[model samples]
Target: MRTLIVSEFITLDGVVDSPGGGDHPHAGWTFKDVEFDEAAYEIKGREQEEAGCLLLGRQSYDEFAPVWPSMDEFAEYNAMPKYVVSSTLTDPEWTHTTVLRGLDEVAALKESDEPGTILVHASARLAQGLAAAGLVDRYHLLVFPVVLGSGKRLFSSDAAKTRFTLTEHAAYANGVQLTVLDVVR
Candidate 1:
């Protein structure tokens, strides 16, 4: 089966809110105000290139649709195949995107013939749901140097019991740490 990977930018406390920008209550104290380096950008570019498709939650698709479409510079991501998980969303504004009606489609995609890498981005609720269903194969946690006492966590309360094997951990010069974990039995 194709591996389902979750690529998230989180804090030490596992809060994944607004590490990009914004003054959200839990995010205000968690993210560092800094830009990514050439290496980091290249790495992200590689990830985008390797990923055959992206799976997003409702909030993430809504959050990304407005901005990512206008970002002409990052054409790879904009052109990449996107599947969004949402129950209430009847119509999507983004091009080259399909809204997954339910969890069954999500499961079908996981079992599809394509040996594709599916990257689930900034979807706390969906990530939790995927984890509970045992669909996640790997968790790529980019733990930044910050902490919010309370916020939207990467692993929410509804998440199932999951354990990860530490496969790799590396420190970048840009103050971001990369933790590669394989969900194990």
Candidate 2:
């Protein structure tokens, strides 16, 4: 069966908003303002390659469409199949992109027996929904150090009640920690 993996860069206080510089409530980036570590960037590149399909929320898709397509580094990610869960976005600007209409179809997608990966990038609400529905297979949370106190958080509502078993962990050179978690039922 296909794995629904949620990979997010979170802060020490569980803030996952605007880690990549968005116009939302989180304008502050956890990493350096514009600069990036080559090695770390390569790791992210590898992630996009390993994941067969990209599943995103409309806000994330719209925010990414304008920027990622323009960058030479993100060419692979831009070309991959992108499925956005949106009610307002009828025609997405990105190539190989489609808008998922309802949860019924998502239920089927989650239950499919495909042997590839489907990754959810930065859709906190959708992620929460999927988590509640028990669709997510694995969670990869890349933790950062700085705390924003109050911004966009990955887990709030029922997500706070969600439990996981720490399976694997690795800390990168940039003070970022990669934690692999298995959903505990």
Clashing pairs in 1: none
How many clashing pairs in candidate 2?
Answer: 0
User: What are the per-model C-alpha RMSD values against the true structure?
Assistant: 2.2, 2.4
Per-residue lDDT over 96-118 for candidate 2, one digit per residue giving the tens place of the 0 to 100 score: 89889766667777677754578
Write one digit per residue (lDDT tens) for candidate 1, span 54-154.
99999888888899988876587788788999888877888878889877888889899775688898888888888878888998887777777666788
The TM-score of candidate 2 is: 0.86
User: Residue 53 in model 2: shift from native, Å?
Assistant: 0.7
Model 1: CA > 4 A from native: 26-42
Q: What is the C-alpha lDDT of each candidate?
A: 0.79, 0.77
lDDT assessment of candidate 2? 0.77
